[model samples]
Target: MDDGSGIAPPHIEGYEILEELGQGGMAEVYLAEQKGFGRTVALKVVRLSKYTQVDQKELCLRFEREAKIVGKFHHPNIVTVYDVGTMGNFLYMSMELLKGGELTTKIKSGRVSALEACNIVRSMCEALSAVHAKKLIHRDIKPHNILFRDDATPVLTDFGIARSVMNSGDATGLEDIPDLTEVSMIIGSKRYMSPEQSIAAPLDYRSDIFSLGVVFQEMLTGERPVNFHDPASVSNPSNNTVAWPQEALIFKPLVTKMVEMNKENRYQSIDDVIEAMDTLDNKFVNESAPLRISRIYLFIPLLFLISVAIWILSPFTTNYELTALDPNNRLIDKSSLSIYLVEGLEKIRSFKSLPVGEHKIALKVSGYRTKVIAIDFPLERNTTINLTPVSSPSVEEFYTFQDLLEKGPANSASAKEFTERYGGSVLSDLVDIWSGENAVLLNELSVAAKLNDPSAQLALSELYDRGWYVPKNSDLAQNLSKAAAEQGYAFAQFQYALILMSQMKYTKDEEEFIRLLEQAAEQDFFLAELLLGMIYANREYRSYDPEQAHRYLRRAANKGDRVALYELAQMIEEENPEEAKIYRERAIRLGFKVNQDF
Candidate 1:
């Protein structure tokens, strides 16, 4: 639907439209050049279709109000609002035009790399943080509202739909209406709507987090978590099933929390989400190391004593017992026995009860050379047995694994130094790992995890469940995450719930996921709480009840999750507009921002 002339609505003020950028149900955005500045900008003009003079006046006022709200924000991540005016019957707002396309388009094209996606999200979080700090809630957040420049930096646009904390004088009257003919009962894009928003409840910043979670999922998986043909379908329980495609690369835990149905179970604030991302990054870099040393040191002596006791308890010369030992000449930990068995096997002779007269045992570990030991056991009495592993290579020759352990303090110090020198680069790198190459970065991760690195374990578990770089191994991921969770890693516990939810192949086990999510939420893993909220909000997942979701979401919103604020506002307002108005007021004070189309 284009003409070569590219002229739209004649001429608006002194500016001329060269081409139509796009059109929505309510308005048309144009690619235009300013008359005096010759600078190109996006010109948004209201459609006057089927409107009376009264409606026109109301619409004009709303459009002007949007400009006023957006123009006040001057952050780098926010799109610049240039001018606002009316040309005859057509009212318009002029704003900065980003050359890049919408985030949705980029995701659809499958060109958004994991790192790039994380970077975009980081910028968005920064912007949202700023908006929240200023006490504004973006009522609507969707891919179309985000403009990505050539550098891949995202500029949040469209403040027309933004709910502001600052008083707008009479303009508040227009926003105060219970329902406007132009106001679709559905407030946000169906695929990205928070539970409260889908129900026409009042909303705040938490609503934005819900939408961002959807956006993050789409960026990582190349598809939206929820797909619907119409806005009404968003609230349909039958359409709520979540399935990550086989081809998709997921950080399971992150996706799980992001898509939590409840606002409280999600990240309490953008900062929390950012912190989770940071933890994931550290996990990807080193999986097990210093922790490995600690585990070996703690259990080595115990394992050796147990093996000796088993040997002593044997009754006859017909019995034989075999045990493996590490390079340190200590018995291998029970947890790691499987790996030891797989790696070292010389021969399998007949097995007896125990206390064999004589036996030969061979042992091998990754870094050490093989060693064989000859043992003789007394048939009638307890005897002692000992075997020493040969040191095949010097510490420097085969020390990549050891180097990972050594690199811990170095990397930490380096990161600190880099951060001090280059500001956010070190943190940015960490975010990249958490959000990007988590699965494939296993060796590095194993070193960190073995060292009981909380951050590394969290990232590894997230990658495993999400199938980021490895096969989707929810069981293994859950096990690792459980270990980390037990260690008091909040990020790990939050992600653990996500893995549990995904593996809920049985019906009765749903409560287990809820319990884990609740635990994580208590630790301030806001995303887990938000998921709990969503679960309670929906009748299908509301076995625990909606009140629970509300309670948790309110907690997160209070912590400054913009998306939660919007959701809570919407929920309260549906039943009690006055109460909803108070929540909305709070959302404004908290500073939530979103694209506006009036």
Candidate 2:
């Protein structure tokens, strides 16, 4: 592209080059005014003069392939290709002229609100879905590749460096073809490349999903999700996981999953991405990046009627964070996610509106458990219902209400689902402990307990430990808690460790108690992390290790355990006052009222 005088080419096969837009990796984009058609078009030209004759032919093949690939797309979100031709030493292609420019321009100025960002991300997903449907991958998915129209409708552009495609998966005939990508040389922008792409590994549509995650994060936070500015380390990410801002806590889980380092962990397809986006509250997007002052002014001119119109036009629906948790309190990823409306449909793929009333909904996740609950929603905003996994049972897989009492772990997904259904009314009647000594209460607890239901066992253990309902049997409390912990219940494991570690009775061995603490800490139970941190940091404790203690403290602090953060600050106070102050401030923000004397 000529920067001065615009004299690179007066006319390229009759299309006059009015001005050079910019130079890309392999091409120079020019704003070309079509002489015959009497319209302006974005003309991209790859100069073949720099390469040898053989390489030039290969480049032409790639260029022609790009043109053919893009020509198949007729979506509203994609930039339409108009013409393709060779002009002297350059292979050129003409595309839709987007006067509003690239989306990167707006992102450079400031972040857009979450709602608008979602709208842009949604548009990108639709466009990418079209490209992916043809079994082609758009290897590059940076913000600059997305353009906007006069009305600010995002249009996905630049499908030049896409993955190579043969005429019909031709392998033997293409044996002589040179590899477009080499392990030594990384393709695509470093900042936007997925974990697989960064390693120069074979990619699928999921790579683009990761790249789009980066773009959307920038749209919300005004900066790329890179912890460090080192390119060498970035190409092979040491720990490339992005940490969402505190302001973005609502959508953090979704964003985190999108940018997952493992390709298998990412959202499978655009359909999945859209589904997750649907459940997310739009208010986060609205707050993440706000509409510009100019955009606000444009709406202001329409007056109060327009505002009312928007409010009414918007769907009267609530959002939910339908999350799945294993018994260990770990998040289950990419489960067989589905939602169904009672009495209407088996699978509700899209939700236009979920009315504010008692709605019977069934939720299922593969390999874990199926749960159905009647939620009085919009009030239960951002609902995170924890479902237990189906674990090993000695007697039978499907246990009945009576069978559940004798089973090993009443903590089965089915048992938990049953409890969720009846626990409300059953517990409602037992509001006061004095009036709760009923046959049904004891019977249900036994069923749940036999099913190895951790919550049920925990409740029973509390009763026995404090002599509330049962004969305050310390032995019974310890045994019941150990049963729950053995089944990988995080909270139960933590409490069980406490009972065993107590010098008052010491029913369990010391070694077993330490192992229980480790189990719960590994699951990131906050108190477990805090307890382990304190124990390991103290020399008087049985096992003391500063390195492991710091690790646990940092983990607890990261999880917003204020005491853990304060402890970390105290430990590092003499070593680094500034760093300690930073930790103290963070702890303070998390509602850990620090000493004013500090």
Candidate 3:
């Protein structure tokens, strides 16, 4: 139980408590060491003073509900829950530890740039979109609940008060809790709550949107709009106005719609908000005078010099104009050929203005193998290149799908056609990662996995690991992950290592876990590097090695992981306090958090 001073870290089986991270009214978060895995996790324990039967039952239900809610999310912007269980009066859940701290700090500091605010809102919108897709409402969408990862990615967390919008068969398992409706009503933070939320009215996903809009404004101007605080203010339809700062006016239209007095007047879905925000963000980046001016002076001179040099060299140099013909003797589109100047195979649009000697260039079209052509350039009228197309039609289709996906979100018609054409094939699942439709991806992967595709297996492994739309099955996840790992897929290796680390206790199993992580790290997988760093840095472990820890942690830090930078500082504090302080400060500027004493 938390006293005025602090709460004692609870003794949880299978985890060694390192230190207390923080505490709220209902829970205390502790930094704990997962035994055997040598992994660090933020362990949240339900903290109650003078616990009664009613209070105990309520807290436990809420705690379990949070785990279930967060567990179902397999999104990049949502926190990952590793494990959950009960120990006497304490109900503890282990989750990914985020060192970048809360969005609250940035908002409170009043130093958030307009771009930063936009990024935060965009990321949260995506997260909430995932929430709403599951027929759930976060209820709480304030800055306090939004935490950041080392990469400065905003992560939606703390789902203790989150409730599903649907009344029956909610996936969060809230139906079992008898008083959940009463507990959820009128429960969110007042300063960020919607008028309907404040009045204990039935809430929907729009309530969360209203709260997020308040958060968005706070991030820009360091204060919530007045209309949200008092229910009476928002009750008046005409008073639904926000006084945005001059610099933040670009966002006013979106925010105004988000916090509209009438839910019907607001954006219908998070997807619509995302689409609008994406357009606004792109416009701001492209058209902002200050942003354009920052590079104009340098870019203009560089571009002009290059253009002049090209024009001056045009006459003397031989122009090796090349045309490619497909297997069917049809002229291949120039855009389709990814031309490269040979020797080093450096990418170029065309072999123009080259020396009149033996010249070689490589052509790589989507459905063809990379073909290198040797040309005696001085006297040739025009070079004709013949390209061989791949035998499989699926390979060609896959490339087309890949190209469409790379350009942008594929159109619904194209996506639907691709799925219908290649429904049960490995190629479709391999390319569907960006489809943003989890249900379809799951079904497609389930079929493709049976065909023994490594990529499909890995993808399915992750889906099962998160239990996003299925029952949580660690055994199945481990098996699938292991199969993909054995095929030498780096991401699969990392994931398999994680599953093994969580379950393995034997020395041989620990060695295998480390081996898998090391394999993935060797492939420059930054997640593996981050995990290896943490594992080697754990002082509680017998295998703790500071040198190895620093090496791996530095690798991850170099990859723009702010959490790794913070951890590096913490690891070296005793040996090199001054350098440690520098690393910590660098992490702080990158939006990571350091303890007050540090």
Candidate 4:
């Protein structure tokens, strides 16, 4: 049968080829129908052009070996291998066909949302865990090998490149293959290959984890952490020269650790990485819930006292803070004190109301000078200042978060100059601004926020809430989020309402939670609006008002919320045929399944 590519496709036993899918380095996959069952299946024909008679026999054995390895793993997240056979001179395998495109396509299109990325990563982890349990390592775990089902469920495919941990013989034969027409010595894609795998060293499950980390990074950032060379010359570059990019594209800490170069330093097991991802995900979700800072702040003093006592008893102690400001700053609040000093320099010391302070601060980078100041002061009254290095060495300056907090509506000369140089987009200028001096950026944000700069308020609020450079303070997070929310930042409003909801749940502050959600929904944060709809739709949370829930949910669904579509479809299944038709049609169009039962 002629495939779509107009090539005469190879005929395999028991399967009738209707069309050609595509060809990879060693295999050509075809869209075929199983004769008796009439089920559409993906048939992959593995070419043996480079294999000698002896090598062909060994290749056939290894192909069967891979088929057995993958067939044993039956997971919803993993692609199911149906049968393995040889037709004439070609070795072939058949598997379930996934109608949806690869994960790479979705990532390239920028259609995979953050939440969707998390879900895909989590599912892949589960699949990896299962495969690893059976002692099979999927040496290749790039985006192309990850297939999505019709419902957008990710299924990891192509275990043909998988290595069997139980058998060491497969490794030797693979090494013996001539390089002329063979796959490179590196068994996997260069960009996603682990350090050990790149060098052809003996690999374990950690190798798979490393590849998964690269996939996770690609899913989050829409770019590969390590640039890959062309497939033919992939082995030419020295592995030591390739370093994983340190840019905070994803901003999640756990996934960063998984991609570490040293195998010993990487996640010990797939379970460990999954646990960390889950913890981080839960923390993020919980942070979105409503929260009350007043009661939480009550415990800070007690914790501070205990920390100070421990610090005083420790043998090594070094503490210091910036005590003065240059260029006659008028941004200082009347109640704010500038005389920051370190108490008990010879003993243990702690910074009160600070996020995780360290001792013996030093500036060793080029073009930066280090200055140290010593001071003696009462423990109760002293302000501990942290000096940040400025980009321009000539302009000596000292600014604190408090200065930024109180700065009036007027951009600093430095802020304006930096903004002009780096472009006004907050995300664009973030790196340069952050690298120079975070305190200055914070101060600039304060000025902009006071001046009613919506962008600045949103950026500053996110930095505070996520503890981007500074220590995390939930109180400060809430305050900043509220400030941005007031400026009609949709994301900030959603976050503020979430925090408020969490606080209400913890402290029984129902009134505050309701008020925040109403404000957030009014500003058109569809997620917040969706939550409100759920609250009204469910009898357990609030009164069951279908009309009220439908109004809000339909609005959000119209704006393209997949969850809202599902919920709206559920709500109007039998109640309103006309409205249900609108929602269900929209839901299907938006890539959400109307009935999940299938």
Better of 3 and 4 by lDDT: 3
Off by over 4 Å in 4: 1-7, 47-55, 166-185, 226-251, 288-598
Candidate that scores best on lDDT: 3
For each candidate, what is the lDDT? 0.58, 0.66, 0.71, 0.60
State, as a TM-score between 0 and 1, how close model 2 is to the true structure. 0.46
lDDT of 4 at 42: 92
Query: Which 10 residues in a row give candidate 1 its minimum summed lDDT?
Result: 338-347
User: What is candidate 1's lDDT per residue for 481-569, written digit by digit as tens?
Assistant: 76666555555666666766766766666877777777777766666666777677777763657688799878867765555666777
Could you tell me every candidate's TM-score relative to the true structure? 0.43, 0.46, 0.54, 0.42
Q: Candidate 2's C-alpha lDDT?
A: 0.66
Error of 3 at 334 (Å): 25
Highest-scoring model, TM-score:
3
Residue-pair clashes per prediction, in order, are: 75, 14, 0, 13
Question: Per-residue alpha-carbon lDDT of model 3 for 1-598, expressed as tens digits?
Answer: 3342333567789899998888787778999987744668999987544477898878878777788778676565788788898875578999888999998888766658877788788878878987988888898888888998776768899888888784635655545654365734678788888878988888888888889988987877666666655557646655645456766778888987887877899898887888798677755653453454455547667766555345334542334467898767899987455554554333442233344457666666654534556676544657887865422123245345545554554565666667677654434544354455566556545643433345667767765665645676766777787766765666678778888887777878778888998988887777678788988988855557878988999997787666788888888899999998998888777656445211
Model 1 misplacement above 4 A: 1-8, 165-185, 226-250, 282-598
lDDT string, candidate 4, 108-138, tens digits: 8873555566667877887888887766678
